[model samples]
Target: MAEPAPHGTPRRYRHGPCHCDLCRAAHAAAARQRRRDKAYGRYRPDVDAEPVRRHVRKLREAGLPLPQIAALADLNRSTVSTLLHGRPPQGVPPTRKMRAVNADKLLAIRAEQWIGAAS
Candidate 1:
């Protein structure tokens, strides 16, 4: 008989005696990804960039300056300016709604750039 998990407690995996290389690597990778996501503020890749853009636009239409808009949006002033000027943010690529897909695409792009530079 299995012990009942405490209220609102998540069940732990019971991969008893299973110290496979693949599982270990997967766990390590997951931990690394979590750290990277936290460090890079990559929490939500597909956070509807349109909403942010629209917010900036509305603020601009309301006569707010670029700096004010940036402050309100918690973004850089140049980013707000670029968006107003119909340009994407520098250094960061466009993101899809699916976070995993967006992250994968970003990683792939970075990898390609690194490989190209090394070649």
Candidate 2:
């Protein structure tokens, strides 16, 4: 169990308009912890994702939205958005590199789609 707030601190300054030093320090520390947690789970995509990037670029050029691209790529909309916007992939642990298998699979799907489009 934890000790209750002193009945005046207002619980880390998040509740209302308190500007006390304690609240400010607590808020800053909480912000830092949030940032660290976000970074810790960030997944760095392959810098050399040219093949998939190019494919995604073309699909975007064709005016296909993220959900459509994701459906065609057989991936999640978030994954397609990360590839489309060139953001680092998220939701995977930083210690594990983004899976090459997924990228390769996208490339293969892109090729298949292109071939199908031609015919």
Candidate 3:
């Protein structure tokens, strides 16, 4: 037999200020919209994957522990362990090197322009 909810048992509040019936419905709808947006990459940050992988490799080469590497890289410790052990980190997509050659070229151009202006 199912036990009835205790008297005056408070209902769990959703994640918003207003808790009226309409407000609750609106909040639920908004939460679903946010989830959809995240799924479609509308609300996600662009994470560069290669840099994270490189950093993980470097940390492993430097003899850093998994916990230490995770703390320094802002990654989960389990992710660090997986990377070190030659396994893929869960839910982390590989990132491309966005500014690899372009960054160097831009820096060189800026340095030349700075020298010309200074001279």
Candidate 4:
């Protein structure tokens, strides 16, 4: 026989097909958290990428290479490359949205700082 599902888990309420009190409470709590997150504007974790793309272009124009820009922005090298050149072959467009935290990080970099440092 299969082992019984653990108590106090939404998983038990869902896949376990168990509707016991603990499972129901867990499911309700999960639902409440989701509702609160949505109400607090935390549900959408991404922002439009256009502004970050523009900033990257500006930084490039200021003579900062892609790798350097990635380093300054504390982002992945591939992430900056993909933003500028897109994927290979099909050359997929830069993603339409990026995580809000990444966008903020990239946007925080100032082109003038690099331009001054490069000189």
**Overall lDDT per candidate, in order of appearance:** 0.45, 0.57, 0.45, 0.81
Q: What's the C-alpha lDDT at position 10 in model 1?
A: 20
Cα shift from native, residue 108, model 2 (Å): 2.4
TM-score of each: 0.36, 0.40, 0.32, 0.60
Q: Candidate 1's residue-wise lDDT over 19-95, tens digit each?
A: 35655555566668778988999754444445445554554565666665455445545444544453343343432
lDDT of 3 by residue, 2-103 (tens): 122222222223322346666666667766866898898775433444555565565455555556545544545544454344333334333344223322
Candidate No. with top lDDT = 4
In model 3, the runs with Cα more than 4 Å from the true position are 1-42, 46-48, 84-119
Stronger candidate by TM-score (3 vs 4): 4
Range of the 10 consecutive residues with the lowest summed lDDT in candidate 3 = 2-11
Ranking by lDDT: 4, 2, 3, 1
Instruction: Write the residue-wise lDDT of candidate 4 on 11-83 in tens digits.
Output: 6799688898999999999889779989998775679898899988988887888888899888878778777
lDDT (Cα, 0-100) at 7 in candidate 3: 29
Q: Which residue window of length 10 is worst by lDDT in model 4?
A: 1-10
User: Which prediction has more favorable TM-score, 2 or 4?
Assistant: 4
TM-score between candidate 1 and the true structure: 0.36
- Candidate 3 residue 80 Cα shift, in angstroms, is 1.8
